[model samples]
Target: MGYSRDAWGFDEYHPVAQNGSNLYGKDGIGFMIVDSLDVLIIMGLDEEYKTAREWVANVLDFNQNSYVSLFETTIRVLGGLLSAYHLSGEDHMYLTKATDLADRLLGAFNQSESVFPIKFVNLNSTSRRNYDGSCLADIGTLQLEFKYLSHLTGDPKYWNYVEKIMLRIDELEKFDGLARNYVSVSRATFSGALIGLGALGDSYYEYLLKQYLLTNKTEQMYLRMYNEAITGVKKHLLKRTNSSHLFYLGEFYYYNGGKKTRFVPRMEHLTCFAGALFALGSEKIHDSFSEENLIIGKKLTHTCCEMYFTQATGLAPEYVLYNTNSTGDTLYDNGRKHNVLRPETVESLFLLWRVTGDIQYRQVEFLYLLTFKEWGWRIFQSFENYSRFPEGGYTEIVDVDAIPPKRTDNMPTFWLAETLKYLYLLFEDPDNDLLSLDKYVFNTEAHPLPIFVPSEEIRGEGWNRQ
Candidate 1:
């Protein structure tokens, strides 16, 4: 609980009462704080925003030699900076800082032998850590931030690097337009045949739709690929619970040589984003398939809400496995019964409420608040049993099904960046127009970036009739 400069360390899990310094040195807390900067602006906390901005500008340093996750740094630090920069009236300092961070991150994509970027990089050295293969999310989620940076800075390299990833993905052999979860960057070959709208593959589909919107629907390739992916999803991943008839997405591995397909009746909190994303895309396209997409989105949202209602603590688990043969609603234990306070469901709830004007969607806010209160109180009471600790922040739920739900010693950055932020947006008046879907699209991490009108010179290649 003692101090170490201005940085805070990870929550101690084994001891449960002790905290340690940052593994990456003194700026870890600053990086975490930057993730919440947009939340301050969203809540209209001017003084807090100013203070945080000052701290970031003065205290945060990216010159360290620590190795960091490419995906994490881009989405949180770069995405956070870009969102804050746009929201704060295009402050030059934010843009400069964001570009600086992004330039260093560009090292990840510098591999000449591979079509995709490496998984991690050292900020100080511009050296990359190669992984065996990259997931769909890692390959495809960079378009929003990088494209936005290109549009702002007029640097084609940022956009061109990320656009290459999209084009490479389009060339991959897919089963009905569904890409495998992991792809070898150097070989440009898929490692597995499994597919889902969850972790590894979630944002690949996400960026397809978002890239279209970000480019003012001028790019037909994005829309065509997204529609094809949706078709593949409906054909392969769509499933319904036996009792509730609740529609959810599941994962499956397809074997070569006509072998039997293996299906897994599981869903993750991360998959909930598809509901809102689909609904949002429907509103824009307005084609024959739009209504079907909207319907699927609504059903998916309801099923995600049910994940919370079925749990004892009114909180959804990190993942759930369904009983495929049960006549009644039954969830199988997959040894992942804990909730990490993820925001995907609530984020979709907020977006669907905006899209449909449904009071029911807005009403989900009460469940979120109730769950947070119940969990917060229990954790606070448990803290008394441990040694005296610092104030503020909440931890994950070890078991949502527990009577007095057990608590994990970790708190994730998304709890503030996405969970509470989306909940806050849900309660805002409709007239505020803070995050109008027509004007901005959110990155996978829930950071909002303005949708830009495509330049006359901007034209995407590799287009064909659908």
Candidate 2:
């Protein structure tokens, strides 16, 4: 409500600055407002939703000249708008805006000889790559939104556009079914030897299983690819702490472009998404491996919680590096140290709680004995203690381990869209009509999209031609 009144159309709400910024601006897209609009609706903040909806209906426009990230814009704004549309009583205005945005975004695809999407969109409808290569996640995560819009609008072009990209990737050569993080769009091939389920690579796999689930589990192609990817992950990247034997998926530079693996000991906080991935997708992995995947999901989730506890502030850093050979102090905080109030860990806890029927994954207590069961609650308390502003809204911290954690100016929109949304749903009763996992598949940004049985047009032809 405060941000809606104070900085209604900015990319983020800055607490210390007492202002807003269009940091990811494509000519004031109201990045935060658009990204978090569904949050307001889902949380039952009617007054706030009204104000935000007014800004969206009247002020939001996608026809600016500036270039925007294809992945970020799709996941945040397009995904948010679509989720809001479905949740807001099938609001036609939201669908109109979402359609307009998607039409423009379609320009980002097929700029190359390949169907791979480029990283940037010139909102005025100019085609540009902005960069030479796209990451696995960026190209791989766009399916649900596009396909759903196709379902909604009876437009097979969108279904084919995104589906062709997936089919192209499906046909590409991969290392034991694992994809390298980058692709040369012009070359139509993988360009790098690195593989990890973190920032550049996390949600691609998350969506594979989800795409299957998203369409009432009829997409055998998505399921087949997802299973192969998981099998490759276990074969090549799965690792353990030296002493505690905790499971962590480590990165790998595949033998200087060959399949024989060498491990990178770093674990990105972004990589914690694998926890939820494993939890949610485990049962769907192949019959013999299903329970094994579930157990691995639980242990991988515990490793993420352990990362938070290793920090002085009880919040995880951006990443933690492990010294696999070290008999002592296996965890090291290196590179990025800020806690931007990311929701990946609790996102895992929420899904784990839902999938496994475990209260311990959320909030629960035992007599005088504190345990990892308190992770979500402790994380919430830490957010208030460190980042919450005196006036309104919370900011990112420079270092979660800092005593009296130093606050940064910007608070990411995902803090609203993903972090708080997951936290709220973690405690909400699952039987409620709103967002049951069986009914909705959340995009990487945590915007929930309804799962529908795909119509014939969505499964229509010509996309499989690539």
Candidate 3:
């Protein structure tokens, strides 16, 4: 509640500065509070939830004369509100807030001659223009939230806009089903032939399977695309180091306009999400390829976890470079050495444990089957040891590899929304009682939106049924 008193409703909190600021679009909005609402609800922090709920009901506003990221806002703010609506017993306030926000963002879609959304939208501007081009994930990652909004409101506009992205992107250029990073919104064409699954490209593949899973496994197109992308991932981007045989996700770039291709042996913290994606794909897709998915999932997750352990602070850096290094040494770039409280590795560990039912996966600090609480506790202790502010909340480390790691005042919003929530769910009921994978599909932001059958109206639309 210290935050409630000191920095409530602010977009971000800087622990050392003891101040709050808004950077997403506006000042004094619920960017901090709203993004963390579903976390408050599922953890059964009722008192905290009450405070946040009241803020959303009374003070949260989506209307403003400003531009906000389509991907960031959709995944964090819009996705959080939508998830809160479901988690909070179908509260109308959250639904109402989500509707208003979605409407403000809807202008970004369909204005382009393409189905993909523009990079940003002027929230309250009366005049709309074609926005700058979007990254692949930014354009492709809105499906789960927007489709769920369509389901709740009985309005097809949300679904139509997002669904067109899937439909149109399916018809575009791909390397055995993998898409490049740059998406041209105005022209309906991809901007480049560079595929970096570490960041700009991770969620595009994630949403493919999730869209299939979100619609109750009825969307064959998404399944086909997901399988193809994973196959392409294996064929093109998956690499193992000669040093330790650690599996890592690399990048693919086409230099001569699809005539020549090169592989770059680089991975980032963002690439950790692919571990969970592969795990989910392994379980959901019951075929001969399931074994391959499981193998890659485990190995890739091991590599990602290695990032945390190999560092001095037990926290992973932003990214790393791998090679067919003969000496088995992974080169850590000094420039990219900070640990920013990223949740990708933790998220992957949680889902991997859930998928494999291997208690060892939960026990990251030891070889034994340590209790899940022990795992979360040890991980928490590491953060507290290195990043906790004596005043309140936690700060990020400037460099985890540095002895007595340097501290930064900034705490990114995902620390609450994802890092804490995944840690909680890692051990929450271990029996699949809360936010069970069978029942809920998490958006890329880690907000859990329940899976439901599409309405007959939704089911009959085009190849959504096909």
Best candidate according to TM-score: 3
Model 1 misplacement above 4 A:
1-26, 257-260, 359-391, 456-466
Error at 442, model 3, angstroms:
0.6
TM values, all candidates: 0.88, 0.93, 0.94
lDDT of 1: 0.74
TM-score of 1: 0.88
Candidate closer to the true structure by lDDT (higher is better), 2 or 3: 3
How many backbone overlaps does candidate 3 show?
Answer: 1
**Pairwise TM-score winner, candidates 1 and 3:** 3
Backbone clashes per model, in order? Answer: 0, 0, 1
Ranking by TM-score: 3, 2, 1
**Clash pairs, model 1 backbone:** none
lDDT of 1 at 222: 89
lDDT of 1 by residue, 13-66 (tens): 222343434435444624556787799899998887887788778777777777
Estimate candidate 3's alpha-carbon lDDT, on a 0 to 1 scale. Answer: 0.82
> What are the Cα lDDT values of the candidates?
0.74, 0.80, 0.82
What tens digits encode model 2's per-residue C-alpha lDDT throughout 56-168? 99988888877888899889999999999999999999999999999888878745566887788777756675577789898888988998998889888888888887877
